[model samples]
Target: MKHLPLFALLGGMISGMAQAEIYKYVDSEGRVTYSNMPIRGAKKLDLGPAQVISSPRRGEGGGNPSSASRSPTPSDFPKVDTSTQKQRDQGRRKILEDEMRSEQQLLDTARKALSEGEQVRTGEERNNYQKYLDRVANLRNEVTLHEKNIQALNKEISNLK
Candidate 1:
């Protein structure tokens, strides 16, 4: 039983060391991709042995080099008071509300136009139903776009802290 455990441990270590080399490739669209499988014109990366570094936990005596050299927030940094921030938030809310109202109006107008188009058949529409369908599709798409815009604006307004 002791020899079996040792043999299994050695097998696991050997399998872990047999990792395939990673290759990087850039496609014609300028997008980079990395994979273990070989690709045409792929460049192999030599990522030497794994590195292990230990750092003391926060509040420990082992001083942090970054904290030692860090400086306080500069006085020149722009900061808005709470009242000023509130005013800015209110102004943003008002603009978004106005845009939402405009989008709602546009959606209503599009729905009305679509309804009118469906009710009345023009001389050209009588000759070809496809034209009428295309117009109706366009109007419907306009209404959907306005609705989506309104929803997005509402979501943004709600997300404001």
Candidate 2:
């Protein structure tokens, strides 16, 4: 019975992958739209054949089969010189640092706002504690989000060569 559901899910996924004709049309308002279903005045798109990548056979590798099947970079692929790559890495680091500083400022602002919000009680919020709590919760979430952004920025900056 458990396997039946799994089979059904797999069947649905396979059916969903069936190719469908795509059409593009410009509406009277000059807006362009694309859909699988043909519409009046819509023209069928001549999309090239879909690219297919074969799944790695089971037991191909003891660990990750995909890693074993991974292809090396093509000979014609573009390459960046060491100096250019270093310059790009420096630029990325500078951008990440600037972002971290802005996030820190936002975190400080959010923290200050949350502290102020928690202290003040006025009007309906004084009697309705839930409303006050909701406001404080939103402020706290903002502070948390900013803190997380700063952490991510710091991690990215540290990863730079």
Candidate 3:
């Protein structure tokens, strides 16, 4: 019957829509991969030989392909709120100054502890004295780090002006 050929053609069209052509590739390490998706980490890129599903070449489209695909160009540099930055710097400086004071207090405590520790004639007391010395060293390092941060912020503000 003439309807038989028409039904077979319709079935073929349905099957074409159901099946997807997977891309296959092999990396430099000789690892073969086949996927219906494209994602990062898989180096071998095969969007299939063109002409069937050709890529839009440059000049073929009115706009640059990158302009079309990419997000709007971000500011060349971050827009710094100078006033806000100065405020933040002031807060940081205050915190650092407080930390320096706290470190000085810790140093004083360690010195007193060591002086008291010297009077005690026991290995445990000497060990305790050494531990206090270590704490003082670490606190000094923290004070130094905070000072550096404050100095850096000052330099940045000066440069902004």
Candidate 4:
């Protein structure tokens, strides 16, 4: 029901474009309406002469996908020399290697913490073994997370050219 006005407006626009007659009306509730068909208390709307637009024909406007894909880069586009690009790649490799080293250190620390945590025993945990298990599980998760980080860093370093 709420879309009636939008539909009416579109209908009026389409009819107007076709040089067909349109009508406008305001009901007792003061809601405005537009339509191609006449109704009681509706007034003829003067939507002037139809407007025409023509689309470009085929390849005239870069519309061919094959030709577009083969288009050369613009003259003003920036270009990086082979040496500069190689230096950038080398720098990226160095950064990735440093990150891999850092992640390896973190993984070793996490593993040590998990190992120590697994061996510890407490009076409270003796009566509630689940608590101890939960603590060790958290430590294990930390170690696993660090290991995954190191693996990802190694993969990233290996990918560098």
Candidate 5:
């Protein structure tokens, strides 16, 4: 009866060993491959004995595989207090608003300059009208640059949470 029990155990062990076979291969590019099913040129890898690790089943305290692969956030990471963050945001908004106002003033002045340049011709411009046109163009570009700056500042302020 004892011999019968030993024979059954041996048979179970043999079946488990057969099911645990793993094959390994290297491709032409030197990348290694591992698989349960044998490939044409794969060699059977003898990994001694399989190690079994028992874990709680999913829905019973064991985390899902996706959660397991994610790294846990560290407890000691720096965090800003809500009030301080709000204050910083307000300060940034104020600075952007001030800059936007300055840009708007500069844009107004540039537009006025462009208008005056278009209306009046200088001594040099009387010889070549292109000179007056070029001055007007430069003034227009300055106005455009300031307008763009104001728009960017407004966008930044609007994006603040």
Candidate 6:
């Protein structure tokens, strides 16, 4: 009958669904094959779902109960270090002073050169020399700006104390 083929087809499907797939592979050394067994010497691995499956959690489904009622708040916070802050402030101030002094010395040398060049006789010579003077003036302004920055940083460090 035609029902015989249908029954056989259903039986085959049921049998296939009932049993999970069995993965087999050989190891690096000469050995026989294995099925559903984890071996230490084998390089390959099987990751079948039922072989290493995890069930759903209790609170996952619709009617599941929750063990934890609510999320937790902060228990405590760490304290800030005030004395180390003062040491950092002092170190920053010293670094600023060193940099400002270096910049000032460089600007002073540039201004001295500009002044000596200006002492030359006037004409096209003085015009070219005035360019050098302008350059030195710009450098002196930059040095002053750096000095101001150093003062501002010093004030910030003092405020932190």
Q: Candidate 4, residues 97-161: lDDT per residue as tens digits?
A: 88888888888988998899999968889899999999999999998898888888877877666
Error of 1 at 31 (Å): 24
TM-score of each: 0.53, 0.63, 0.33, 0.52, 0.54, 0.33
Error of 1 at 132 (Å): 0.8
lDDT of 1 by residue, 1-161 (tens): 86999999999997676564788999999999998777999998788877987766667634766564345568999989999999999999999999989988998998898888788888899999999898889888988998899899999999776
TM-score of 2: 0.63
lDDT of 6 by residue, 82-145 (tens): 8887787788777767776776676666666556654654465456876666665766666576
lDDT of each: 0.85, 0.86, 0.62, 0.85, 0.86, 0.62
Q: What's model 2's lDDT at 70? A: 64
Ranking by TM-score: 2, 5, 1, 4, 6, 3
How does candidate 4 fare on TM-score?
A: 0.52
**10 residues in a row with least lDDT, candidate 3:** 38-47
Question: In lDDT terms, how accurate is model 4?
Answer: 0.85
Candidate number with the higher lDDT (2 or 4): 2
Better-scoring candidate (TM-score), 3 or 4: 4
Cα lDDT tens digits, model 2, 1-161, are: 87999999999987665445789999999999998888999999988777897755666653573475567679999999999999999889888988888889999999999999999976989899999999999999999999889888988988787
For candidate 5, list the clashing residue pairs, or say none. none
Give the TM-score comparing model 5 with the true structure, all chains together. Answer: 0.54
Candidate 1 lDDT score at position 30: 96
Residue 99 accuracy (lDDT) in model 5 = 89
Enumerate clash totals for all models, in the order shown: 0, 0, 0, 0, 0, 0
